[model samples]
Target: MKSKKILVWFRNDLRLHDNEMLVEAIAKSDDILPVYIFDPRNFQLTPQYTYRSGVIRAKFLLDSIADLRKSFQRLGGNLLVLTGYPEEILPVLVERYDIAEVYHHREVAHEETKVSADVEDCLWKLRINLRHFIGHTLYNKEDLPFPIKDIPDGFAQFKKKTERDAIVKACFLTPEVIAFVAIEEWGDLPAVEEIVSAEAMIGEVHQELIGGEEEGLKHLNALLEEGSTIYQKSTVKGATGKSGFSSRLSAWLALGCLSPRMVYWLVKDAEETFGTNPHFSQILLGLLWRDYFRFMFKKHGQHFFNDYAMKPERLFSEDREKLLFEEWKNGTTGNEYVDNYMAELNTSGFIPHAARLLLSTYLIYVLKIDWIKGAAYFEEKSIDYAPANNWCNWAIVAGGGKNTGTIKSAFDLDKQFKLLNLVVYKQ
Candidate 1:
């Protein structure tokens, strides 16, 4: 009998629990090689000249990778951490390890999908299959009521149909033990400075939220035990500038340190234990929104990053536009609420969802700057930035995407501020 060797490529899905790719690889292979590649391209400047990922986000990612490696170690396996392009690096690994196949989670955004395609192409030359698993969303795409092409353009329709028809799948059991191929060097985790620019490193690190599956799971458990009153009040205060008290699970979810299904089931258990909570529903709705954005990206491709609905023209010159953008980015736009929110984002690499809405509204409708630029800045700054959610939400706010109907006049500044119990800012 011949032994099977498989390579498990770790992308955003970085955890041991609820990882279909890891479980599948363990089930099928005699020895598995788990690897994570820190692609330099991800750290390069965006087209809008912002860091593709700022220093704090880069640090959080590194922390997650380190934590994941520790998890594999505890399971009697090792994770190979390398810094290079996956497309170029994976084939060599496949050949060296005598891997019969590679398994990875599929990504939806254009850049991520392109990287997957490139890796697949390279692996094809080696005649080794690269199997893709869908494990990111709370609801699997196959379970959806509608096909990708026919998915509702508006969230309301999508939410209504999917909630009624679809079901959240149970999480994959965490592997207790694993066999890893022999390697002299698993590679050292790089420091945050090595992965980002000095300029990006200027801001305060969001040290309160440490990265890794252990921390993520702990946070989830703690949140559930805290109950609805604390959760609701914290959320309200976060919006009203009292304290940053939202779930803050996004940092973990964005990195795949926390599984959405795991979140759903755990929240369900909490509901069963403590009775129904509206705040719990809000958390689930957030997961649904996350799924919606990813599916929308799959459906629309690069169009999510474009001005799909053709936004009204702005009269400002390029120089004037740059000035306005700088003010907004620096939290000096003279609008007290917007400035405070921007300051929080710039300093901590995070802000509450309400802050995000108000800030987006200010940028798109009030200042009349290009929403793409704002999205680009977020791509650079946000520690929890998921490509689909970030870009698609910006498009929705700009009134230039399939979601326009779902959130009619979503960027109406006065209405948004009032909803948050915030005083409308005067220009």
Candidate 2:
């Protein structure tokens, strides 16, 4: 019997604990190589003139991988960092290292699908077993009530369907510990300048946002000890009590440093021990919404990024709105609520969900800007920015061209002022 050499390629799933792909690989192989590629293609803009990822996220992503490398080394495994396409680099690795199998989390978005296909083609040439695991979402797609083609058109319908019936009983898989393979020493992580050209976008935004299993577990324990019980009340308070109840687990979830299942189980445990709290229920609602959006992307394909809705309506028009978008992006929109939200997005690369909704509505309804522009800006800034949510929400707000009821009613600035207790800025 030959000893198996399996390569567990880390993409967004950066952590070790409760990682299904890592667990599967370790069960079959003694010589396991953990690899994370800094795909230059991911950091570059397409010829279509849209950035694949924004500068803040680019920096954060590199930081996450760098952080993961350090942790992997401590655990006796080395993270192999390579530059260029995975198809180009991975096949070379298989030849040099005698890799017998490749394992990674399954991703169903447009770009990832292409990358997956390319990797499959390359691996087929090498005759290695290519394995992909469902490691990202709150619920497994396979366990859903319907096929991706049959997913509900509206989020409300989808959420209800899954919560009521299709929900899978959650399970957490533990990774088997494998002895580290000696790989060559890699240099320091790439700087913002090396990956991107934006000066306003360069900074270590992730120093506080640590990566890896140990750091993730520490943060989870800290939140739980501080009472993960209070998340709902905190989330409603927006920026202030956000940490108290909201879990702030997004960055970790985005990087795959922590599994959504773990978060779900812990909250369930808290509810069992401390009893039902409205706050906890609200937090769970948010998680369910996140899962709903993921399932949405799987069903809709790249239509998720376009301005049309699931009902085949054109929701936003580029020509109908032009100058309004300039003001919105520049934070000179004159609408205080919208500008404030933009400021938060520019500064921290984050916005509370309510803020995002209000501001996006202001763009499409009040100011009449192309929703695609707003979505593009979000793609460039948000660390947690998932395309499905960003584009779908924007389309819904912009009224799907024929102006469906799904579009939120255009907000009255005066009413908003009263709700937010915002002082009127007389322009």
Per lDDT, the best of the predicted structures is 1
Give lDDT tens digits, candidate 2, residues 312-407.
Answer: 323347553455566676677776666766766666666666666667656554554556667777777776666565665666565552234334
Q: Quickly count the clashes in candidate 1.
A: 0
Q: How far out, in Å, is residue 369 in model 2?
A: 1.8
Writing each residue's lDDT as its tens digit, candidate 1 over 1-427 gives: 8789999999999899999999999999999999999999999988887989998788789889999999999877788989999999999998887889999999999899999999999999999999999988999888999899999888888889999999998899999989899898999998988888787787665555788999999988988997765662333342444554468789899999999999999999999988887678878888988999999988988775445444645758889989999999999988777787787788778887778887887777667777888999998888899999898888777667765665563335456656445443333
lDDT of every predicted structure (CA atoms)? 0.84, 0.67
Quote each prediction's TM-score: 0.93, 0.83
The ten-residue window of minimal lDDT in model 2 covers: 232-241
Model 1 alpha-carbon miss at residue 29, Å? 0.3
